[model samples]
Every structure is written in C-alpha cells, then in structure tokens.
Target: MHRTVFNHGIKLLKPTQRCIPVAVLPTRQSLLLYISNHSLQNRNVSIKTELSGTNVAQPKDANNVAHKQEAPWDIDFTNIVEAYKSKSNYEIFRAAMVFQLCTIGFLVEHGMTISKYMKKVTGKWLFKKSMNMSFYGHFVAGENQDEIRGVVDKLSAHGVGAILDYAVEEDLSEEKAEKLEMDSCKSNVTPEYETMDRYQPHREFSDRRKKVVSARTYFYEGEAKCDDNMNIFLKCIDAVGATTDGGFAAVKLTALGRPQFLLQFSEVLSKGQKLFERFCGKEGNLVDRKFDQLRFETKAAKLGILMSRDESQKWFTWMDRDDSGYVDLLDWNEMIAKHRKFSDLFVVLNPETGDEESLLPKFTDEEEAQMKRMLIRVDALAQRALEKNVRLMIDAEQTYFQPAISRIVMEMMRKFNRKKTVIMNTYQCYLKSAEDNLCTDLALSQREGFHFGLKLVRGAYMEHERERAKQLSYDDPIQPSYEDTNRNYNKLLKIMLEHIKQGGKADVMFASHNEDSVKYALSTIHDLELTPQMQHQVYFGQLLGMCDHITFPLGQAGHRVFKYVPFGPVDEVLPYLHRRAQENRSVLSGSSLERSMLWRELRRRLFKGQIFYKPT
Candidate 1:
C-alpha cells in the first residue's frame, strides 16, 4: 500500500495513486491527528515549491536518515515534567513566582520606578542578595566567565547550547561624563561617607559645582570606556569559544562607541539612502542603474552631502572603472565605505545661508576617531570569533541607530563571512521596512558571494521606536499591529527558507518565543527535507529562564537551540532585567502558559514524592 503527500493538506488516497500522502504537513495542533490517522510505514514526502509549483520528492531513506535521533513529534511542548526535569523543584517554584509577579499589571508597568525605589530602600547587601536569589539568578547566567561556564555546562547537559552575551550596554557618552576624580577628590564627602551623607550639600560640594573650568575636561574618557568595553567583548568571545565550540556571542555596537554618534551616523546614512532612492527614480533594485555624475552631485548637494569638483571627478573616474558612464551597486557601496573612513565625497563646509547649510550634524575629530576605533574593535572581535570557530551576532538596536548598525555589519560580513558563516546580523521584523532591508542585504551578499547569516527577531525596541517617532514628528518605523509584525516575521522566515531551498549559502537563527512561528518553521523544515547540520545552519533561541517549554522540547527533539545567556554584575544588568520583565508582560499569555506548566510539573513532582531541594 502507498500514500501520496501534497504540499497543501494530507489526504488518504488509493494505494495505486502514490506511495505517501502528497501534501504539506499540518500545523503542530493538527499534526498529531494526521500522524495517527496514517501509519508510518511507506510514508513518502514530496515538497512543492511555492513559486514554481513543482514537487520535490524526498528519497525513500529520508525517514531512516536520522532513525536513531528522537523524532521531533515525540517531544511534546506541553510535557512540562520532562521539560523541567533539569530544573530543580526549587528553581521551578522560583520561576513560577517570578512569572506570577510579572502578571501583575502595576509591577510590570511601573517596573523601572519600582526598581528605583527598591534600589534606595533595599540596601546594597540585602538587595543584591535578594535579587541574586530570585530574578537575577533566574534571568542572568552569572557575574563572570567562571560562573557562565557552569551555566553553559548545565545547559549543554540538557542538549541546549548557550549564546554568551556580556550585559554591559550603558551608553554614557564621553562628552557628557564629567571628570570626577579631579574635583571629586577635593569634595568634603569622602569615599568613606555613607550613601545618604554623600548626597548632603557641604561647602566643598557647592564649591566644586560652582567651578566652571573647561581646563579640566575629560573628552577622551568615553574613548577609554569604549576601549574597556572592547576588552570585555574580547573576553566574552574567549569565554564563548572556550565553553562551547561552534557557540555564539552577541555584540552591541553602541557599547563600542558613543550612542549619540551612532544616532548622527544613522541620520547621515538614512539621508544618503534616500538620496540614492530618488536618484535611481525607483524603489526596488538600484544596484545596476546607470550613474550620472552631474545628477548625482546635484542630488547629493541638495541632501547636504557636498562634493568639490575635484572630488566629484575623482569619484567618477574611480567608480566608473569600466568607462561605461555608470556606477552600479558595488560602486555605490564603495562610495559609502569611503565616506565612513575618509569622508571623500562628503565634505563638511560652512554654509552662509540656512538652505545651503549641511542637514547632517558634523562630528568632532575625536568622534570621528572613535568611529574608527569602534570599527577596529568590531574587526578584532570578528577575527577572534573566526579563530575560535564561533559566530558573532550583531544585535539590532533602536531605529535611529539601525542604519549605521546595518551598514557596519554588512561591511563585517563582506570581510569575515565570505568563507564561513562567522558573522551574523540581526533583523527586527517589526519594522515596516524589515523585508526590504533583508532583501537588500541578501541581494548584496548574493552578488558579492558571501555567506549571508542573520538572526531574525520580532523586534525589541518597538515601543521606543514608536514613541521617538511620534515625539520627533516622523513616520513610525514599527508595524501598525502585532499581527502585522508576526506576518512580517513569517514572511522573512519564508524568504530565508526559500533561499536555503534553492541551495543558497545562508544561515538563519529564528530567535523568537512565539510558538506558532516555531511550529511553522519546524513544519517547513520537515516538508522541505532540509537536513542541514542542525546546529550551525538553523537555530532557535530564547532568553535564559524565559521559555523552557519551547527550548527544552526543541533540544530534546534533536534541533539546535540556545539560551541567550546574559552575564554581568547585578547592578549593571538591571536594564536587561527590566526589558525582560516588560517583554514577559507583553507576551503575558506565553509567560502564563509557562507558569501553568511549571505549576503542573511541580504538582506532579510533589505527588510522585520525587522532590529534591537544593539552594545554589
């Protein structure tokens, strides 16, 4: 007897028609029913291409390929007892308590205010101990590399990998940070003074505040901090490589340089991209468009990117190497790169009138130097990752910083990702232009023959993006609705999957907590018969201590999954904890479901008299 499979739906057909059901696998909810209705014997898989409408059938040995591996269908996401087995009863109880607290509207909504109050009243010793015992212990891996190693081992034992993330992302600018050592040394409030007394207004304090001296400026302090951050990143890369081969380390560009500079750089890139769009006179693909020097210079000047006649002629001759009177996409990319390092085509000149003034903010010499320093740090990190056989994932930031962030990551991809998938960029699908950005980058990678790697996220900075857009009188970058965001995410996932199907050199980490999207991806992976090295090519990631139900089951089912393990001092990672709390609130139902599962598992363990208690 034979069954035929189709890409749409499963159906029972005459034995003579085909050897297996010729249809797409049903979703997670319906897959069990479909599997039960038909026997596993003689079941063949045929995947249909969406665009070409052609069937690509799997080999008869497809079912037997990973016969020793546990089938994904055997592991149920709701099997809380099994999922929480690695977690002790006490840990489960603590997680449940945390989730229960997150369910409270006021606590989650007013988290930052409450955190401030807690910081004031709790006292350093008592507060730090309490946090470490509860939320901090639950969310963060540990305070240092040694601690993170233990967490990594524990997770690895459960078949889950770790993506090490150093949690020091404070963006205090060098220009804004005061040199406290000089004047602070002269204050009446000594280092021995208690917290309350330190705030007291003494004569010395008043005198220090009254002094207005640029003579003791510390403009280079921020650069030093950037260097410090870079060292920490290097340490993190080492930790990741040492703990887990083929592991991941997350990088935030804001940590390497001043955040204000990133915002200004983003503004410049956005304006330049817009200028290119207008010059090309079309939206889709501007890579092959013929270039006109006069028109390009005129348009760039209007956008406040001035070019001298000599510079214009120089750029034209260099870009139009073929003498075809046209500079394509690669030429445009080179121009952007030159603008970053040398400001070749973009000359900052003083304008006599408002209309003729540069629309972009000019960077100080120090800021420009810091930009180079930041890029050097990024390259160093990439080199370390490549040497250690680890992948570097550049995290997505606020929309104002994304243009610059994306451009920088693309350059890194060009440098390091040509041979292996060492550098991965992140894309936040909640943005309105998520697909467009992904398509543009993917096209560039394809044209340039680099291994394109990315982490697809639903987005973290939507609230901030929208609020800033509204405050600044600009169009909102976020999608209009949550459903739209999901749609965008799934669309991007499908695009990547299709590229993989076509044998393109690409890797994607579906870093999401949405179960439906997870199921959708799993179903498609099976349907397409994409049996790549599961660990390196396709990945599923959830934050530490957030989604064990999804994480454990995916791991148990023989899929590559990792926990986004954040590590830093307790006080320094408060912002990360706050964001985690807010995200839990936003996905209240998911958290509630996990909590319910935890409770059920707790009940099971209690009734079974298998409870073991330990305090770490």
Candidate 2:
C-alpha cells in the first residue's frame, strides 16, 4: 500500500492521521528511496497525543524507530552553480574564501583573540581596511541605512526579504560593573542620566539582594547609550519598510537596558512563577476551579509571601477581571504581566532580612527613571514597527536574561499584536524547557485574545550557558546532546505548524540553517495544504554570506525567505562576527557539506576556464 502511494503523486493516508503525499520531488528521490525501501515496511506507526498540539508518528517497534520518518521531499542544495549565479564572481570568491577559513576549527575557535593580536601588529588603520575587504565585507550589510539600502534591494530582487539588524549589543560583566562603580566614586562623577521628578529617592524597601548586587553596576551610563540604540532600531524599521513590504527589524532587548537589571528582573519572575505553580496544584487551574479571596491570600502567605488580608485583597480585586470574584489563569497572567501596576505582586525575598519585597521599591530614583526610559525606548521601537508594517522580532539572549526578555516582549504583543502580529518573541529550542516555554506563551496569547508571533532557532549560546551553569553550581539549561536539540526544534515546529493549520492566530519564522529541519518544515507546510497567500505568515531565514545554498533556493522556489542582514561599524560588530564564525564551525569544518558544495562550484568554474569570471 505504501509502495502504491509512492508511485502516484496523490495524497494517501490511514484516514486517522492526515499524511502528506508520499510523492518525492525529482531532486529528492535518492534520499526518499533510501529511507522508504529500507525502513518503513516493518513498523506500525501510531500518533502520540499530548497537551500541546504536537503529533508525530511513533512506531510500535522500538528499534530503529527514528529512521522510519525522514521527510519525503528536500530542497536541492547541490545545484551550487544555480545558487551562485545570482551573486557576483567577486562576492562568490570572497564567500568561498571566508567559508574556507571557517573550515579551520582552530581559527574559528580563536578567531577573536587572533584578530585582536593581528590588529596590534598591523595597526588599527590597516587592520580596519583589511577587515572591511574580507570578513566584515562578507558578513555585514553596511554601517548605516543609506549603505544598507543596496543590500536590501539586492535581496528583494531575488525574491528574498531582509531582516535588518543594527549589530550593537550591550552586556557588562559583574567585574566590569564593580570597576566602573569604583571609578565613578573616585572621580566623584554624577550619573549620565538625571533623576525624574516624579520618582522618590533610593528607598530601603526593594529586595536587598538587588541593592547589593546591581545598585552600583547597573549600567547607569548605558541609560544614554540605550537611547542611541533605540534611534538606530527606529531607522532600521524605516529601512525595512521602505525597501520591502512586510520585512523584519531585528531588535535585541539587552541592547536597550542594563543587563544586570534584566538578570535581576528575570530572577524575580522565575521565583514568582515557581511559587505560582506550587499554588496551583495537580490540575494547574486551582484559582479558576474555586473562587475565594481568603484561600488565595492564605495560599500566597503560606508560600512565603507576607501579604496581609488588605494587601492580598488589592491583588485579588485587580485580578478578578470579570468582577465575578474569581481569578482564572488568564486573569492572573494579565495582572502579573503589568509588573508596574502591582508592585507587591512582583516580589522577591530579601536575602539578608528574609522578608518579601518588590524589586521596584528598592530602586534608587535614578534607577526607577532608567527603567521607565528603557520601556519608553522599546515602546517607541515597537510603535515604529507597527506603523511601518514591519515585523519586529526580539532576539533571544542567554537563559538568565531570557525570561525578562520574553516577559517584556509578550507585553508588547498584547498591545501591538491585537490587530496584527507586529511584535514577535524568539524561542531557543536547545533549552531544556523549550516546549513548556512555547506552550505557556501560546496559551497566554489565546487567553488574552491576541496574535501570537514567534521565531524559532536552535540556540546560539551553548558554550556560555554550559560554562555559566558549571561555575554557578546549577543544572545545565542546555539540552544534553545535538540530537536532543534537533528533536526539540522539530517538536516545537510541529506545534506551531499545527496551530496554524487549525487556524489559530499565530505567526512563526522557521529560522534555521539545518537542512533536515528546513525540509521537515516545508514538508509539514505542504501536508497542512497552506496556500502561498496563507504562507505569508510563515518564513525561513539564514544569515547573510552563509548558507546561500539554503537561502537562494528557498527564494528561487518562491517561499517567503529572508537573510539576516547585520549592519554596523567594523569594530563594533566584531563580537557578532566572532559568534557567527564560531557557532557555525561544525558546519564549516571537517566533512562540512557547505564547504564541499563551494568547492564543487569552484571546480566547475575552473574547468570552464572562468575561474575569475564576472557575471554579466
């Protein structure tokens, strides 16, 4: 029966599960044949059910189960000449050279250190020029909007959209923050930002841990620098809107405020959420099942909150939205999300005093003002994106910072995503709690009556996250192995795709460089029978100067695709460049498919006696 289905280019399934046609594209036949002829005949497939909308075939026989369901279609990445035909010979040559260097494990791993040493030996002037002609030229779009316009237009010409990123990030370590604090005290210098008139002076009620850890080193100077980043993002939004309809503007939340504040903020939420979870026992919806103000207060106070009846009543009254004297998950989420509204609700215990207090009350007047300023900047950027019809995608950072990032981005979505999915959050699938994160956010969006927007990526901060966990004596946040990450990525992909198939108000960008993941996404989309117009909400993305084989074919095949066009001054974007090189080293070094394809294309060009041939 499976063989018959394969012979015909029509859909056939077990009537219980909606399987896509077994037909393989001409380019994918070899791969399809290898899997089908060797694996599928023996196993009986069963669809696994879960709370989240994830459904995949599970074989009854445990052995070799993973091998039975390779996607039946693939994008032909081997057509290297066709993919490179759109690029100039010089561009291709430079990319080939850059990727060739990326193939060297030692160089990629130590690229930043080596570049710094080279700069010292070569002098800054010569170093800048050389970098501009090589790595910088290949990876980044340009330094400013006027320069970036050409890159956008070129990508648009090839049916690919552009995601403009102003590659400036701000992160300060604890040691650096302490140093700055000492330096400022020695100089007797006032902070760069002035205090707002409405806020009170630094108070004693804020959680003690925050005051001790983040008070002096919270990037007070960055108050002004954050404003600069906001302006750059505004310009990026304009550039995307002007150049292409429905383009994307990539914004990093860490770039907008102090990293320590975010870390502290995340810590507060993390603890609060765990307490909430415990308060909602077995079924997870205790607040909704029965409505009692005293019960709620008793539960909270027993769980370490020192709220009096009157104090807890303010929360109960506010959270009981329908005025029925009952709070549901949605109602609780609504109140918790407005962190500024209920200061007592967003609290952490004072480590020294062992008493609960809000993070806000402890803030110095300047710190409170700084928090407002950061929100204002984020609001302005989101407003500009909405006005410009640009999708604003917030990039995911480290786990310590991610909870706060997700929290704020969701707040933006509740506001701007009412009519359209203008604000999008990122999900890093490599995390241990990836599915839970996705399910929670998806549920919130549904309950709040807003569009859910997301971008999925296998995380980039693997080494940093692992090392930090080891040093801090905590459980590692990253998945144990590469295969685990891939499985999580695909599972999350299925959940979102199924949501779209069911006509849920959601949008997702399947941003990845992994070919198998990409093929699986495409296959799932086809199975769901989404038309090209419906696919406007779906997207694929790869970085500029990397994975042209995937990006170009995706564009040429008429799917909605985008290149992450990072732009900044050469010196400013070094960190981003280094990460780009280092993170992709596995794909570029030893037995890398991309390098082999580049080599194949280079060989073809050489044999044709057009090694340096410039495309007309």
Candidate 3:
C-alpha cells in the first residue's frame, strides 16, 4: 500500500499491468500501516509522503543542497554597536537641550545678517527651514568658540581634538571686481613680447605690425595695474594674520588676484612664434631696394614708405648709404630688458605685505591710525580664538591655485600643528592625481619635520572643472569613474594609516559619506589590530543632517568626529547651500537603488516610532 498526491491537474497512477502487491485502506491510519507493512515485506518497495495534491517530486539530493545553501537567519549587530561606541562622548553633549540653546544664541550673535540675507533670497519660510536644516543642523558646533568648549571638552575627555574654521567668506565688491578685470588683462600679456622688441628688423609693415605696440603696451599697463591688486591681496593676508591665529588663517589664491592672468599668459605663449614672425617680417624688409632708393633720393621720404619700413618702430639706424636704416639691435635689446624688469618687479613684490599708506580709500593721518588700531583689534580676536584651543581647517580650491594655498597652509601648519593639529589642509580624491598629490604632501611634511593634518574629500568641483576643461580643450583632471576615485581615496587612507602607525608625520581626518568607504576604513583598523586610542589617529567627518546613521553612532561610540559649519550672511552662504541642494537632487534622480534604500529606511523608522513627523 502507498499514498500519492497530484497537483497542477496532473494525476499519479499505479502501473496497471505489473504484478505488484497493492493495498487500499479506507482510513488514513490503516493506509499508513499498510504502507509500512509493504515496505517491511519488500526491501525494493519505497514509501514516501508529499504535500497533498502536489505533482512535484522532491529529490533528496536537491532538498539537501537547497537546505545547505540557505543564508543564516541572524545578523551580527555587535560590531556595528562597537564601531559607534568608539566615538567621542562630546558629540552626546552637543545633542543636549542646553547646547541647543547655546547654538541658537551663537547663531543670533554671529549669523543674524546671514539669516536676513537668506530670507531675502529664499523667502522667509524657506529661510527659516534652511536655518533649521543647513546652519543649525550642520555648520555650527555651539554658540561660540567658548560655548563650543562643551563639545571640545567632551571630545578632549575622550582624547579627541577639534579644528576650527571661521566662516568669513565675504562678498566681492565692485572695486574688487574692477581690480580683477585689470589683473586679468595684465596676466594675458606675455613676457616674450614685453621682453623682446616688437620692431623686428627683418620684415615690411603689415596689419600684424600695426597691432604690436597696442598689444604690448596694453599688456604692460594691465600687468602694472594688476600689481596694485596683488599688493592689496598681500595686505589681506596680513589683515587675516592680524585678526586670526597667525598660524591658522587660510587664504585663497583667487582672493589675491585673477586666475585669467595665467590663462592669458598661456595663450600668448601658445601664439608666440607667429607674433614673432610678423614682427620680424615688418622690421627685416628695410633692405628692399625701392624703400632704400626712395629714402636716399628724397629729403622727405614718403611717410608710407618710412612707416612701412619701420611700422611702430621708435628707433632705427642706417646700415649702408644706399639702404634705409635697419631697426637698431640695441633698441630691440633695450625693449627686452625693460620687459624683463617689469616681470621681475611683478614677481618680487610680495602681495601679502601692506602698510596703512598702501591700503587705500584716502584716510587722514588719524583715520590711518584708527584703522591700524582696528587691525590690532582683529589680531586680538584671533589670539582669543587660539587661547580657546581652536584649530583651523582650510578648504581646497582649483588645482591651478592650489599650490600657492598649499604653501601658505604648510607654513601655518609648521607654526601651529606643533602642539596640536591647529591647521588642516584638504585633499580632493576625485581628481585623477589626488592620491599621488597626497603622497607628495605627506613626503613634504616628513622632510620639513611638521605634523601633517589632512582632510580627505571626494571633491566638489567635478562638473564645473570638467566643463571648463572641455571648453578650454584641455585634458579633464577629474577621474572618469566614481569607483576609480573611491579606490584612490581608500588607497590614500591606507597609506596615511601606515605612515601614522609607523610613527611617521601624518594625521588623517576622513570626510566621506559612502558606506563602503567608511566600513572599509573600520575594517582596516580592526585588521591592523590597532587599539581604540591608536585608531583615534583618524577622525571621521560628515556634513550635518547627512548620514546620521554613521555620524551619530560613530560619535556616540567614542571616535573623533566633526561637521563642517559654514556660516556667513545668508546671501553669501546661499551659493554654497544651493550647490548642496542641487547635488542632492541630482544624486537622488540618478541613483534609484540609493533612493530606494533611503526611502525604505525612512519608512522603517516612521513605522518603528523612531522619527516624529515634521513639516519642512
């Protein structure tokens, strides 16, 4: 006796013609007893049970393999909690009600104008929302440097340190705009034309010759005027130094002068041979017989002939009695010398140096004295900040201007990073060469004997940089793939970690949002068998209101962490906020998987009663 089930409208039947013993039992227990008896009587007979009415046959091998392949039923949350536990305790203090009140007060005192400006640009409602989201959420630590001491104290209690970056990106003025234009014009002028005589002794006058003086003179005048702005910029550095911690103040290269100067210089150099040829042709054609004969035969030579022979030439000398005077080599040499002198002057004048007399807006002697007094006040404020143990982190800009900024910050780091990391430089890993650049900077720190502090970012200026490169027909500097950039950033982190472990000169601060990157770093720390304190050699940073899962837990766990707090007049900060919003929207639109995960997380939190509903 045997029991069978059929499914999917298929029937199972016993072989009709075969000589096989079969028992039919009306009751379920009797049928089972019969099947057991048949199985016992004949070893060849097999007994089986199946789901009712199912035609599907389950093979023992298949069932066993499937069972073996099933994933584990439980997840390990211990490591996640441990990672979070490793963060500084001070972050918990920041979440307290008292700290929140202090943060509001600080905003009122320092960010009132910024708030007003935001209201004007984004409307009152949006401005209020943004204040809650952007400023209150991310850019601020506490009410003031002193008020933030609670946060610092908390971090310090856990052996973590803080770096301070004062929000002082001021709006560009009309005067500054005009000065930039003039600087741009000067930068376009080439050293070759400025140094070499435009009057070539080898050619006849043409349209090309007519343009030389105006071109060269324009370049010279523009460069000279531009130097004044450079002087002003130098003064700005002094001004920053006077006000902020001398070893912590960061200056942008763009703030000093126009970037177009270098571009213009490059353009001129690119077209150098053609311009030289044109000038040479105009100057060299003096030996043409018609011009020479005409000049010798008549006391008054045709102005056209003379002009054609020496178009724009200030001086010329006769080579033979029969020939028209050739443009003097000595004159050419003098022009070159003068041009070199101008270049030398521009290079030698330190734009960072300025005195009251040089900083203009025509002041009376008393006013000058008062302004100097104000600068002294600025210095006092900076010193106060330093006494509070504030650290400064400088942001990285475009590659072209980065060298200058790097040099400036390195100098500051040498001065301030001695006792603690008071000065930090940024590394943008999205650039193709960023990893290599980081290595180079690390080497520099080692050679110079300075404790290096670095903030690693994925880079913010990718699209703009790429488009500009395309328009300019230059090779794009950004990495083509996100993975490539991410890989490089991680590689850099590994290198930094190795250096730190070896007791070499380096301090690392990671500013990232990618989960993989954060997890990779955590895993690396565990694999290296580094202690929590040794692991504190690195700090994780995230923007406020973003990745709270990582930040909140990490901070709670006892790791060193900080948020970038950008503060300014609302109008001044609008551009930065707008960029952030735009980027977020773009990310959401482009990455469906990420968007889905975020939505799911949000829903789960809402369902679990972990998040309260709030209207934006």
Candidate 4:
C-alpha cells in the first residue's frame, strides 16, 4: 500500500514548461534508456531556453520540493515525545507557566514606560506601578543591601552572578562639597582650577579663593563629604563579597570632583614647556649648563623679586644698580622663584574649602594647612576600599575629568589589584577614540604586569558631550553611527576574550542591551571550542530590566552574567530611573526585530492559555 501511495504521488509531479526532464524514471526495459531520454530532453530545453536569462527552471518534483520547503519547520513527533518522557508533564507545564509569567510581567512593566518616554521627553505619567514592578522584579534584586542576598543566592543557583552598584545621588552641601574638592586636589594635582575659572563669571575671585583655602578644609569640611560616603560604600561591597563569589561594585568619577577642574589641570601640565619659556624672557634652555647654573645661583634673588610689593619698583631698583639691556639676572631669578611658589601654593589649596576671608585677595597660611588635612582623608578612603576587597568599577564621565579619575584609579588598581580585580575601568563605546583608548590601556596593562578589569558600556553622556563639542567648535568624540560603535564593541570583546582564553591577566564584563553583540560573544566562544565553564572568563552584563532574552538564556546555560543593579534613596535614584526608562523606550521602538520578538513571546503565552498571573 505504501509503495502504491508513493507511486501515485510521483505521478502527480510535472515536468518544466520548457519540457526539461524533471526526474529520471526507470522504464520497464532498462535504467539506461531513461537516462538517455532525460539527458536529451534537458539538452534540447537548454538550447531553446530564453536568451534574456531572467527566469530559471525551478525543481519540478512536487513531492521533493514540498519536503524541502517544509524541512525547516517539520517536527519529529517521536523525538519530541522521547525528549519529554524523562520529566513529568506537570513539572514541564509548571516551568513553562513560570517562564511565561515572568516574561509577561517584565514586558508589561517596562514596555509601557518605554513607550510613554519615547513619545514625550517630560513624560512623568509613565512612572506607574507596572513600571516599578518590572524594574524592581527584573532589574533590582532587592531594595537595600540586606535584601540582595536572597536574590544573589537564587541567581547563583542558576549559574548567574551579580554586580552591585551603590547608586548614591550627588548631594550639594557647603561642608561636604568643600571636602570633596580638597580630596580631589590631593589625589590629582592638575591645574583644573584655572580652566574651570576661565568659564565662570567670577573667575579671578574663584581662582584666588581656591589658592588661599586650606587643603585640609577642602578634604575634611567641604567636598570631602562625598569621599567620606565611600566608607559606607565599602561596607556594601563587603556584604556582597560575603554573599556571592562573583559580585562587583561601581563608582563614578564625578563622585570625586568636577570635570572642568581636572581638565584645567591637565591643560596646565601639558603646556608646561610653553609656560616656562614665557616665564623666562629669552628662550632660555634649562637643559644648558649656563642656564642651569644661573637658575641655581639666583634662586633666593628670584624669590625676593616675587615677594616685592611692586614689580615696577623692583625693576627700577635693579636698573639703578646696573645699567644693562635687561633687568639683572639676580632680580629676574627672584621674581621667577616667588611667582613659582605662588603658583605651587595655588595648585595645592582646595577651592571649595574657602571661607569669606579665604576667598579674599590672598589665602592665609591657615587655609593651606586645611588643604593638607583633606588629602589625608582621601587617602584614608582609598585605603578602606582596598582593605575590604571591594572591586571598584569606576564609571566613565565627561572626557575632561576621565583622565584625572583614570590616573587615581589606575594607581589604586596597581596597589590593590594584586589580590583581585579591585579597580575596573569603563570604556564608552560611543566615543570614536574609546577603542583606541582601550587598546592603549590594554598595552599598558601588559607592560605593567597587572590584571586589567574593564567594563564596556555604550555610553551615557551623548547629548551633553555632543552639545559641548558643538558650542566649543571641537570635533565630537562619539562614533559616527550605531554600527560603528557596535563594531568597535565586538572588536574590543574579541580582544578581551583572547586575553582571557590565553589566561593572560585581564577580566572583561560586557555591559550592553544589544542582543546581536551578546550572541556574537556566545558564538565566538563556541567557535573557539571553549566549554561553558572556561567561558566564564567573559561575563555578560545588562542594565536592570533590559534584554532578558540574552541575559536569562546565557545565565540558564551556566554562563556568568550580571545585572547592573543600581540602588539609592528614592530621590537620588529618580534621575537614574528616568534614564533607564528612556533607554528602554528607545531600544524597543527603534527596531522591528525587537518588537517582533516581544510579540512572539506574547503570542506564545496567549496561545497556550497560560497567561494567568500568580502572586510573587
């Protein structure tokens, strides 16, 4: 009966319209006759074929073509039954129900907010209960430090790790603000003050006041309050350390100081040679023997000139003593030394610590003492973070301040990274130079023989960075297109993976919402023939409440994964939440691919009649 059915099916098939032999059927006489007849018919059809070459003959075997077309979606019922035989049907059903519920809950909560925010910039109404539930359930493990442990344990059971961020909002205060300023000076002695002063309405007074204020006051009483908060931050790290094996923490550069200040300091250091030439009337070479000797012999004389109440008076006095083309070397040296000392003093003082009197024409000796005290406090904070084994992931801020923070954190990493990845640097993929910067950093890590920890982020400060560049008539640092940034990110990831695979000293965490990048990393690992355990070298990170498709599956498959859970007081976290909502809305609406996946998941659940909710 089966043979008869097969024969009937084959008989229903047709030859091409051009009479090309579609199949070589066996004749009653012999197979050789069938081949000869088929070949001759095909040859004739080829010769008579249209010369335009637009249409090509398609397969004429209806049964074969149907099977070929259906192969992709065809299911083996026997294999499906065997796959489920090992497990109870109820258990399978329950698991499926849970998965659907979680997915639906996630979409409804975040999707609405994303939709609303995408439509309106000032859309406050989107912050509804569903949104909070989605963010809290999917993104946040717990509200405070204590609540994270249960979540951590559950995730660990599923082979996922967590990254804890103590998301504190900036609080402006006279005392705390001043301490932050002073501590910044001690950690980084760049001429940031001068650059920042240039843009301010009261540049001269601000500059003068910063010079006069004591470094200790800047550290202890002013902006240093933010640094002091580090003590509490370290405690949270300790908690995570005790709870989970692969947990990490994060910090921000702005938490330390303003970007303008650091940029100013970098500019001054960069232009040191030019400034030195201007200070010396002639293009005197300090490297020359005569210049060196002159500088050495008249050090006190230079100080005396600088100390003189009037520079004009001192010049006239020098002219009276000796008639020469220029002021005597002795007077010039004295003036230069005094000027140098004053500049040095200005660089050391904390701008934020000054009282009304300190901001006066000149800073008193007492204010200088205050600046020194602030430095000690900052050092203490660094010491605490190191002692606790708390890995500090320093977030990238504006380009201006990033260098200053990098220097400080790199120093800390050198000191503390010996034990573990204590300091992690973040690269903003949107920046054109970020990839180059990362490569340079990797080279430095190789040369220094220290473990390099890096966090790759798409970037957070795009609008601000671009606007500032436009206003200043400078080239924008961001990538020209999204594809460019993704390409760079993947390249960096490959570099990181290579470093890890070789057991070279580097740790990488990919923080992205783009599913393609995540899939690429996974595929790369598989192509490299590395097992899941060995592939733990690469960590997949996503912001809380975004891209569960990548995160959950990789996590379930035993790959190390992390959610960037940010927590702080409600008011402090509002800005961060707002940004999160904006990003979700932008990502969801921007791509039809994402929208389709979301709809697919939604349909799958609805079709199964398993969309009913249960209490968490």
Q: Cα deviation of 537 in candidate 2 (Å)?
A: 0.7
lDDT of 2 by residue, 145-234 (tens): 445555655565455655544454333544555554333212122322222211111122111112121011123344576676566566
lDDT at position 21, candidate 3: 15
Q: Each candidate: what lDDT?
A: 0.60, 0.59, 0.39, 0.43
Per-candidate clashes come to 15, 1, 32, 35
Model 3, C-alpha of 66: deviation from truth (Å): 45
Model 4 sits at a Cα RMSD from the real structure of 28.8
Could you list the CA RMSD of all candidates, in the order they appear?
Answer: 18.5, 17.8, 33.1, 28.8
**Model 1: per-residue lDDT, tens digit, 454-489?**
989988665555655665567888999999999998
Please give, for residues 1-616, the per-residue lDDT of candidate 4 as tens digits: 1111111111101111121111110000000000001112122221111101111121111111111121111222123222222223332343233234434535435543444554365354344333343443344444443444444434333334445444433434445554444443333322233343222222222221122110011122244544454444445444433332333556554433333344443333323323333334444323211223234224324422222224334434432223433333333322222222223211223425531111011222432343223223334444554554445566665555554444445545555566566567788888876765676566556655778878887776666556656666567878888789888888888877877777767767787767677777776665665543345445667654444455555554445566654444443443344444344443342223333445554455457774562212
Cα lDDT over the full model 1: 0.60
The local distance difference test score of model 4 is: 0.43
Give the runs in model 3 whose Cα sits over 4 Å from its true position: 1-189, 193-253, 256-389, 411-420, 568-572, 588-616
Q: Each model's TM-score?
A: 0.71, 0.71, 0.47, 0.55
lDDT of 4 at 182: 45
Q: How many backbone clashes does candidate 2 have?
A: 1
lDDT of 3 at 459: 75
TM-score, cand. 3 vs. native = 0.47
Name the lDDT of candidate 2. Answer: 0.59
Task: Tell me the deviation in Å of residue 192 in model 1.
Answer: 50
